[model samples]
Target chain A: MIPAPYLLYLGHSDDPLGIKTSRGLAHFVPASCVGEFRHDDCPLTVGMPRMTLAEGKAAGAQTLVLGIANPGGSMGASLVADALAAIRLGMHVAAGLHHRLRDEPELVRAAAEAGVRLFDVRDPPPSLPVGNGLPRAGRRLLTVGTDCSVGKMYAAIAIERGLRARGHAADFRATGQTGILIAGEGIAVDAVVADFISGAVEVLAPARHDDGWDVIEGQGSLFHPSFAGVSTGLLHGAQPHALVLCHEIDRPHLRGLPHARVPELAECIDANLRIARLTSPDARFVGVCLNTSRLPEGAAGRHCAEIAAQLGLPTTDPVRFGVAPIVEEIERCFASSTPITTVSA
Target chain B: MIPAPYLLYLGHSDDPLGIKTSRGLAHFVPASCVGEFRHDDCPLTVGMPRMTLAEGKAAGAQTLVLGIANPGGSMGASLVADALAAIRLGMHVAAGLHHRLRDEPELVRAAAEAGVRLFDVRDPPPSLPVGNGLPRAGRRLLTVGTDCSVGKMYAAIAIERGLRARGHAADFRATGQTGILIAGEGIAVDAVVADFISGAVEVLAPARHDDGWDVIEGQGSLFHPSFAGVSTGLLHGAQPHALVLCHEIDRPHLRGLPHARVPELAECIDANLRIARLTSPDARFVGVCLNTSRLPEGAAGRHCAEIAAQLGLPTTDPVRFGVAPIVEEIERCFASSTPITTVSA
Candidate 1:
């Protein structure tokens, strides 16, 4: 596991969407974030205290988290230098990029000399079994999306919190890199061998005896041609009892592919449910989590209401508003026979 | 490419199915087979002349092909010793197993000392792109299956030969180890990173200016929980104009999974066509290829006729009879405007 109290590195990124790792970490686990680091030209921040390597070390930061993602997941020469500096200061370095940190000889040497660790979060654990598609005990709610970066992770994290607050047993199961960072552990299902995509997910969220809910963070959309295979495997592996359909209301097309249009909400839900039934026959839709952050507050509320009325499912923006409606829908749909006594966290 | 004039290594295998690689090589490229090497007590053979490493080298063998697969693809000590003996004789060693010959220090040292290569057919090439799902120029036919080991590769290879004989341009694109060994080169789609399965396949069968038919070997069944993801990704990546559904008639259940039943021919055809259309809008089934080896000649013929009438599609065993019927159906369905003169291979 990556050390807590991270000094998040923003690098030279200016795009707000590109630095979602830092944003997610600060938003979800702000108590564990010590400070932020960035170049002088880097105009982005996750709203943490600015600090140098020495300053972050003095502030009790145990790890330097490279929290920015560039095109192709490549690490520039300057970013390597920054990581090296962090290593020299005896701080462990962690990144969730397609390019692995262990591949950098300089970083490897410096980290070894300084007795610090390097964590490449995108790497899957070795020797994952092929998926068996067996019925596993435990209730699961997976957040599926109409496209990538549609707030499935955020909705999952929020749903987990909401479930626990209502005296329900729940755990957030991360499936991607950013979710892995926030949850402290998860397999990057997309990086796994093609044969083991579903199997990896099966390992990630195994059978639980407590009948607790595994709030799984989903990846790409089923309609997304570039990543639909990974999405399908994860769906089948999850065998989710309940699904929360997540959609960014303003998405004109699928992410990156201009030729491929976003699938309709009904189409997305139907496809996900149909494929999910291969593993979990009782799978059903729990709610609709809309990413209405692009809309005005009044319009967002009206949009949620309209969708809720249209589909007869609870709808809300898990980030902008809250996941209370979705959580209530989950409770109503899959009410437990032996309810647990409420205990405040 | 692996060196031709291969000394096929049976490696103490007793199961006929376990020695399919050797059998495939011996069947498809008999001229390249120098001789076979196996333990004296081993009863399995691809029906080649028996020889030791020294005798095989004298017989002009350039490589020792590990043509046996044990459970979990593990390399036993005896197998390593046999491989080392070949390396010492200045011969390259090739294997399609999950375990790599390069992973054995003794084999690596011997190969390096002898200036010989170690070929791992399951390892994919680096830097594969994500599939764009854009229309590529080519007429393609993919052989999909109702379950694993249902003659997808054999059908693909046979179809390529039949198409070429009919003066149609065709190439066999392999997607598995045995097929890769037969084809001399291919990307094992299952071994690829989960996100790049389709991308690797797209690279494997790129746009052909000649409008040739790329007969891509298919992988796992869509109904099989262990590997449907690989199968789906391959179907999308191939974007075939025509699909050939391959199935074994007598199989009671999905391979290795006792709980899962094999999908019906119609269900398999429907799923493959529906998924293939995501990339190739005009994707349609041309014929069905059945593995009728388990049935008697008369029963196989009756079975083929019954299914042919029931589905209104040409059905035949590519191995038992030939792929001529399926190739004829393909020509009838997608006839080229300008016919080229047939050239004998």
Candidate 2:
């Protein structure tokens, strides 16, 4: 029944739950699970605008099956009304919710209407350049979507498929990315952190877009989720050098949340690199992007490669850990200390 | 013709423009034009969520119609493939591409689906919420629809009916404003500057669920046409108190186009209030929300009410102006003139 010509369900309470699709039960249900029907009415809260011929008699639906409730299991309005019934009725909707589709709003408008490309699920997801395009001045990853499906394209395709399996040259700058503007929370998390600072180290991913993604001009918390609007859209696009702080641990199917806790994901990547070095102190360096989905075959990626070898980033995935080995260990800690010009004043 | 059940045309180069009704195109374009057609893409591109489900099935439209030669254009990939055909076909979609539905991701997922309810073409139909039924807070001018109609619920109900006509209080805060954090570009230019800061002072509005008005985040320097995602969702959701720069001196019809001359809408509202006062320098205060439609009604709203009475907070509506008295005279020239010690921290 999910054959989809438009079937949006999105429920939690108002009722309408069962729909099944392989081509069996499509009874029509949802007017709160069928009781006397005729429900619709929300043209921006009735100031008017509800016409299209009363949504074709309350949706006799060529297949439009809207329903709602959930917004509590961590965000939902039936996923923003099945993403507004597939963006105002282009029709062909379907939903169970699935981890609140990131930030809901109709599954982030049905993953932007099923283009479902962004992967910066905030953190994790990044494995590193595993496949699909990118690499030619590469090293990118910008996924931003602070509100819509906050996954930023599943964390920039799991960190551009884990830096293309440790070879290098990642991609997703979404078209632009030269002197590294990177930016946050959308455009696929700053093209997956400018493809991991151009070298394709390990993880970056953050910054999804639509009309969003600011870099500097006054910082702006870098798209919070704790600076995961893809590293605050790459420290407001390009104030980058170091701020990689990915996190993801827990496996019984991605358990325990809070970024999967590794000391609370290194205190949320050292509190987003001290809030991106207090909002850009010329950015110093910092890295982390672990997530194996519940440890095992290699203990949370070898305990994040011994916690980035005691914070120096020797990690190239001896077992597994990324942000391109912590941006090559924060570019070898600013080539051996003395940097930190106070967040690029 | 612009009817319902399901109809989508959505175009660009090929032709066909505008027509997205949820409940009234007269029962499936009973007369008008009927299941229209056409496509070239550009609905806000990037890959447009898989080119809006392959151009909504090559414009045969399972139920989606989009157009965006440039109506408030910006989120490329053809408006994320018209937000993936209104989030994967929940349909009834139409987005000739206007600017002010607060970030239109298919009308923010059809007002967050679940018993659906969206209809905005300047609004005034559908029904429901007649009295003590809806309002819980205020500010709700929603018209969202990124892919098709990027008016994000008509700039969230024109910023909750221009902050309830200015007495303040407003409503339509999407989903509890759980995250209506605007900073720059879109989100309908920050829900029309949080509906002009709930009509120049007092505050609150921003709370409506069922999706549409809920999670409106957006942030800084987005892009051209209409993309600062509504001024970065109003500087990541009202971080303003002083900045109001405005531009559009003439050629303005915005989403409906007509003449359109954005110029970056005053440098994207001064780079989204210089990044919301550098993220939160006391959530800096800024002003200006002009759209006099090429200036008239008391000319630029009376030159923004004599510059908000030389920055003191005057102007009741010699024609309508209240950028919060020049953002309280630029928050009284910084430091010490404090007041918003914390709105969330």
Best by TM-score: 1
Per-residue error (Å), model 2, residue B296 = 54
Worst 10 residues of 1 chain B by lDDT: B336-345
Task: Give lDDT: candidate 1, residue B162.
Answer: 91
Tell me the whole-model lDDT of each prediction, alpha carbons only.
0.88, 0.32
Every candidate's DockQ is: 0.63, 0.01
lDDT of 1 at A154: 93
Best of the candidates, lDDT = 1
Per-residue lDDT tens digits of candidate 2, residues A89-181? 444333222132444454555657655322212231233321111111212223322122222222343444444443333443321111121
Model 1: DockQ against the native?
Answer: 0.63
lDDT at position A114, candidate 1: 99
Q: How do the residues B138-222 of candidate 2 rate in per-residue lDDT, one tens digit apiece?
A: 2222221212232333233334444334333334433111112111012222222111211111122234332222212221223
* CA error at residue A189 for candidate 2, angstroms: 15
